[model samples]
Target: MTTVQEQPVSTGGTPSVVLHAAEGLHDLIDGHGDENDRTGRIAEPVVEALYDIGAIGVFTPRELGGAEMTPRQAMDLFRTLSYADPSTGWVTMAMGLATGLAGAFFGENAARELFATPRLGIAGQGTRPGRAVPVPGGHRISGEWSFASGIKHCTHLHTAALDAETGQTRFFIVPVEQVTFIENWDVLGLRGTGSIDYTLEDCFVPIEYSYPSLSTEPVTGGDLYRIGIGNFASINHGGWVLGVGRRVLDELAAVVRAKAGRPGAQTDTVAFAEHFADAEVRLRAAKALLYEVWEEIEATLARGAEIPLRLHTLNRVALHNATFSVAGIAQFAYTSAGTDALRRGTMQRLFRDVHGGTQHVSSSPLVMQSAGRELAGLEEGKRWVHFSLK
Candidate 1:
């Protein structure tokens, strides 16, 4: 069993201090190293620390008793948390994004009830394989939703289902008590995420707790909710990949320096040095691109304008850049670190984490296809990223 240790929160300081404390949480986990690989035991301390410092609600609306930080702030926090443990960062990003989406898409009553607590972690599945049958005043939802991350600690859940009559897909919020947590998240990477399945059986969902997928109604009340769902999805996962990439580069640099004076280093000294320099350049270029996209997103949010198509395009570009950077760094690290990186160390773990980061649906090939289709003026099929512009 992994030993869990919660970091104490510091009071009476600037917001940067709070952020610094949050970053420190990552360092603490990184110090644990391989002990963090145990499934279902790694993220408790980190999640507790985040709850203690109120970092989990960074994207929740202020009116709902959350900080309602901007997308940039949310991304920074995820990146910092991810440097320590990708599972912890994945769960945090998943919960934070779901909370923000709940506030944006759900009815006011549902939002109030869900965000009433200080840290309400949510797990959701977007695939609408479930069925929502209309009852008198609500809907009877029944189906098994897979890939519900952080379900063990979640108080609320968001699930997508299709109406049998009209064939319209909708999202529903259900309490923890109403669903059963199934242990289905056994994987080689991100094992600590506890992304288990939840079984829903004749769950009665109130009318207010459900909304059509891709809400067309304007999110009038909260500025945080006004942000489009596609934009949120694009930006949230970008931070996760960026953090993993950063870790890969850091580990590569350390390993290269350690092996610099070895006999193996003498054969192709100039070529190896060039490879290290090239990796650094590529990593820096990726960071610059991520920052440029972030600045554009911030500017758009600052102006209170709807998410333009260009923002989605930029998000796609940012994710692609980060993914390629991570792959490049991983290749260099694995090659330069020789056989040592194959052992259970920082580089090995970082390699797994970086690959896992790229496998996320948001960062997958579909995003690239969507961007290409949009650029070519071709009609993209139904997608989760499609939010109605009202």
Candidate 2:
């Protein structure tokens, strides 16, 4: 339940803005690629550039003055941007998804009001590290969540807590100011995400500002919102990993070609050839799994039918498998490149980013296990996994 603002968001999103942002991202990746990765921060300039292109709030829905870009479009954008730099790609995906989640909760009118702010974006964690107590007009929420990506740039945070009165869970939209950000994001890869841990201490969230993340009745209705958030995140980030895999494969191919002409290079080429061919087969298979699942989900939605457990499980499998496959591909490329990649090149960074991105729970085998259990017509077994499916 969201309070409707009298002012409605304008309903218009020109494709040109997205296209421009894509091109700008390419240029930025080329110019600031290493800086972004090493610094582990998305600079203000890049944020400003994204804002100028109206690429910051893809979630708000066209009717609500947000881009309202479909999951397919956003995923493609994320993949393309990731080609230049995965860190930026990671941040972009998180921001876009956060915005979309907010749009899904904010209903129509409030969404417009929120997205109307220049350069507004959202980011937060799904895991509950605290509790929300029932209060006068709303719930007083206090919790800590880890791995909140792109928190440095978002306008709001989307979090959840167990209700003090009821064992049930509820989600909340908190203004960024209410969050106590803890700079604890050091990591092995995906450094640019700046995914620090954050805390919220008894922040009062009005009823209009909170809802269940898994609710069937979204305040705002659209094809995008109609698609459940779990499915949406699965496919959205799935595209990202596919793109990253493509980049790593392509970069390795270039290296192989460059080294082919060198004296005594045929041996390495032969080795790389084997690795590339094998990786190609695996990557293609993994990539296809994602699109197949995405298409089925869309078809189900188009038919106004419930998304079956099979589709959800398949989506989870594809996303996790794709991530695992890509990370393996990067590892193969790294081994093939050996000392060459070890010398700290783009391939090296891609190797690290791929590995880092896979660290997300979304890419974990636990998700795949849940999917397998569901497909086998068995219980989810794990309470946390079962809860997410709800």
Candidate 3:
């Protein structure tokens, strides 16, 4: 188990503090992988270690006492953690994004109330809109949501709901106590995420606690929030794919090196070497493309301009390429590792995690198709609203 730091981590303009913490926790996180997989949730010590390092709020607004890490910094942070353990990286991503959104969208009163605590972790799903009925002071939300990643360790929940009368999807922040857990998170990969089902039974959420789903206008914070949640999510997903891909390749290399001296080893052949080189190029190229796209987006945001359709289109394409490219690389690693990958270990777990991550809506075939349509100038006058070109 990892030892949680007694002191709070500093976010004093030094992203290295967070990244170093992530790198240092590799052994501890990897050590708990089996336990996390078996229990369908991350171990408490690992979770505490992450919180102690202030990783749970990597993307939250800096003014609200979060790291508010830049795209490059956030990418490094996520990549480091993911390389240590995919599930740990995944849970951190979910919580960080959720907490950042809460700080960005909520009103002053809600923001103060939410960020009042020293440690704040938020987890919930927004893909499926729930029903929200308006009342005098607030809305009554009632619906079942799936894939609430990291919910078991969260202090608050951020869910999306549709107001039938207005046809508007609104995001609401509710205390974890207000929601009911269904606890059906059994899955092949990312089991440590504990992304189980949950329900809100006519939960009364105040007007101050909710924000319009498609609004890019933030109640607080600067450039980061301006990119909107969709783009933000893409950045995180891209980082995670890069990290997981790197780890898979590294592990495969170790296996190949160990087998190199064996008599008549198949992995030592020229053909195998060429194939491995190609895999390296593919993963490296994918990562470069992702970083390039983010750099462009960051520049646009810094200039106080809305991210153009072209950039949004490219962002989605970058995520798609990164994800599928990593998936291919992982496949190559597994096939190359042969029977060794069949045993229950890092290679096996990563194979499942990569496949499971591919199922996410961010990198779905439909989303890629949408990006293609935009790139081909077929979606004129349309803009991205979440994963779709609206």
Candidate 4:
């Protein structure tokens, strides 16, 4: 594992400032857990706090007025933020990852405009369901994007669409103003994410703001567009799951300690002490697995090599480890806390958040199956499965 630099309280950089500002926001959000579920407005405060603390630009390339931290550094940041609050960690990780992708894959002009601000939020949808038709100077894009986390606070969106002219899939940079947030993120967990629907109505996007999925051509005007999409996406999602898993483990430990003496307090005979110990072992194992995979990702980036198929498998494994850890921690905490955990409190909220975090497609069973099939030498049945950072 890489020895991450001790992040200063304030690095005097935008990323550092984000971390500094978010220092107390986690507690504030946790304090408002009830409203977070009812109004989906917790993300707004979280974004503001992140900006106040300088936590948003770790992945922003130096050329884009931000730090050029490695994937490992980004993961370290995520782990820290997640321990504070998983929702904040999730939104920050998703936006940061999107920013990194934009810096690495979008055109130079697009990169400059997108990252021009000290703190920018970008949201993305993996499924390319939008339509893009070439026109005189740009493309006419129109579609509805769903599950766009942080959409309420996003300044830009990275959307995928199929081009009508060449039938090739492409990604477009759309200003948040061009899309209308539909307030549709109703779910059991991560409700604070404000992951609503976005409607793009006949939006005209410039040609320079888009890139074909397989293009290796350099962006004409910016240095931020040097990173590849596949590799960036994998790393971003990896950090997100890692942060959430770590947070879940922390919550579980706290709950166990609090309830360890409930039934046999004076006797020190906690009924499920062994179970809690086993769960801790599993959580540690999951953390180790995720860190190993992240190290592989960092090594690949350092070598300037494309993310290989094996690395994708490893990324999937890391995500699997995160989900498994969340499930394990929740199970251990719930079992140890008994019915008390389900009451209206921090434990209940944490339980819901962890389960919600796992529902993301990045951490879904489909990802595991894809990795497994690749390992077994099965023919890639879907174009999405055929995708690799390399």
Candidate 5:
């Protein structure tokens, strides 16, 4: 048995894995976030500590030693963790989402072995294109992938490629030893994610270890998997943005309160009060709509009905809203704090981190454009990142 022990993890009603993680995020987890940022890698103690909270199991099925959280539950977990720290939250989000997708894409035995350890998590780049040549039982994988978040502490790494023989995209499940970490994670913010590049050299992945990215349905059959990829992908993006925005607000509030007694601080305080209130309203509206769409997705899935167009519509709108809202919040906080905000390890980092989120391809405004086009009866079935992620 793995050192990561089992505990009932729920979202409040039963103290599910996400809730457990929420309650278990203590000083160690909180303090190490900055350490991870400063060092450009997550500390071993922090990784191990996450195991205790079942962070890796959020989307993993119970049969595979995972928590099998509903897609929405997993999003809530990411949001809560981001509230503690965005770097840890990004790592957790990458691990959970990648592992979950692996579970769905890989066959039972392969999935089982991958999730054999209670705390096992995978990391790799999915964005870069690679080439796979046919071999005896599998394919030879050779490619360089970038932005592999949390690769330093991951058990395995994953990538997708163009199959030479069939011309299909194949998922390559590779042991960490076969891949080389590039030590190129230097960044302005969200520095702790270890979002670096990795290369595979003549790596042979067995047939069982590889699968067509779109050929299979999730082995862990559920309403969550039944929901289309577009709907499922929106939650985590919104959650991360929401949490970071909340943190900006929380930190700015505390700073404003601390400076309330200072000479000439009241003017800034009054301005901050108004901006903060406005920022909260926007953030909450985005969050409320996000969850409301999520609930609709669950209901639609539960009723065995086709996922609604509105689900994707709401998802795209919420994602864009959250990203912009967080950007606005960071700006307000920065102006409110002025020179102190410009200092290192201050509002500046949060500003960079939130803007960094906007840099994500998924958070791109193009997503909303495609969704809008689809809503207007245009060709959009497989034109977006959702198809590739699925």
Candidate 6:
């Protein structure tokens, strides 16, 4: 088996500063993960550390004083952070994506004003479009959105609303304080994410702060933004699953080693050894496939060409495989570790986190089926438009 010290797919650029910062916070985040889980929010100290390390700005444009990491670098950063703590990684992923995309979509004046802070954090739901009535200077939006991850620590929100007049969906950037947060984040895992429900009542968002939902054209960034939000989010989810999967396996390995000297250890069997090797290979294969897809997309974007239908379809399938395959690996680790994973500890938390990851819309059965349709050439002249073949 290959060593666990695998490096992320590299696309020749300056080394990632965000990756180093994520590494530095590993111990701190892991230590407080339980506490953060209990509180249904990331511990204050951990949140502060994320902001101080500039991890929340991983995806924002370089010109806007954010990291603007390449897709590969961003994936590595997410994997590193998630390996430390899944909840922490999930929150950071939501905030970073929302903030960066908002900046990319908004006009220069709005982006300059909104992202002026070095530690800008954003959260909101892009699916489940709300209502937006056209007004004189802007649109008055009113609706509720669910699973606004990282909303507890965010400064602004990026919500989707359907324009009543134009019938087109648009994303409105609003201050977090303007919305009423519904305290209902109770769930099976990643509790520290605080992905609660939120509502806006007649919130007026200026035209400059709103952009079409499908617009890949960025006003403040480079080619990365041109890939659209769906593809960008896939990178984050893919990296997160890989990290959590690695953690589960690594924890199980440590447990097996610690019990090796004990008499008749459950994991001492030859069958368990073979199964462990299989799990490791599965995860490694998934990671390799994910990176391969991203690397090709990176090369394409660098050449100023639009992403082809095949690449987009492959991105979805790659993420589906990464997520589900990791969950399978986690199941193996948990079962092989026996009662050790059942107790309240890192192993248990990781098992829960990995399963929680499997429920994300990005890897839902419908999305997978959609990808399959594309790959089978069953949807001729149809292209993927946000998890669907249309």
Alpha-carbon RMSD of each model: 6.1, 2.9, 4.5, 5.5, 4.2, 6.3
lDDT of 6 by residue, 218-289 (tens): 877688888987897678999899989989889999999989967888799999999999999999999999
lDDT of each: 0.69, 0.74, 0.86, 0.64, 0.72, 0.85
Collision count for each candidate, in order: 0, 0, 0, 12, 5, 0
* C-alpha lDDT of residue 333 in model 6: 88
TM-score of 6: 0.95
lDDT of 3 by residue, 139-205 (tens): 9999999999999999899899999789899989899999999989878888888999999999999
State the lDDT of candidate 5 residue by residue for 1-390, as single tens digits.
Answer: 112233223221222745665657756667776677789877788787666666766766554556667756777787888877788888877877677667665666666666665457787766556999998989898888888987888878878888998888877878887888889877877898889998887788998887666542566535566554445557667778888888888888888877877888853556657777898898898888888877787788789787656565666777787888788888888878777788876466778788778887776767777767766777545433452211
lDDT of 4 by residue, 142-165 (tens): 888887876666778878888988
* Per-residue lDDT of 299 in model 5: 83
- TM-scores of the candidates are 0.86, 0.90, 0.95, 0.83, 0.90, 0.95
- Candidate 3 overall lDDT versus native: 0.86
**Model 6 residue 19 lDDT score:** 76
Q: Against the true structure, candidate 5 has what lDDT? A: 0.72
The candidate that achieves the highest lDDT relative to the unseen native structure: 3
Kindly report which residue stretches of model 3 are placed more than 4 angstroms away from their true locations once superposed: 1-14
Superposed model 4: Cα runs more than 4 Å off: 1-29, 32-34, 43-45, 117-119, 214-234, 263-271, 378-390
With a 3 Å backbone cut-off (N, CA, C), the pairs that clash in candidate 5 are 9-16, 9-17, 10-15, 10-16, 10-17
| Least well predicted 10-residue stretch by lDDT in candidate 5 | 1-10
Which stretch of 10 consecutive residues in model 3 shows the poorest summed lDDT?
Answer: 1-10
Query: What range of 10 consecutive residues in model 6 has the weakest lDDT sum?
Result: 1-10
Mark the regions of model 6 whose C-alpha exceeds 4 Å error after superposition.
1-15
List the candidate 2 regions with Cα displacement exceeding 4 Å: 1-12, 15-20, 266-268, 380-390
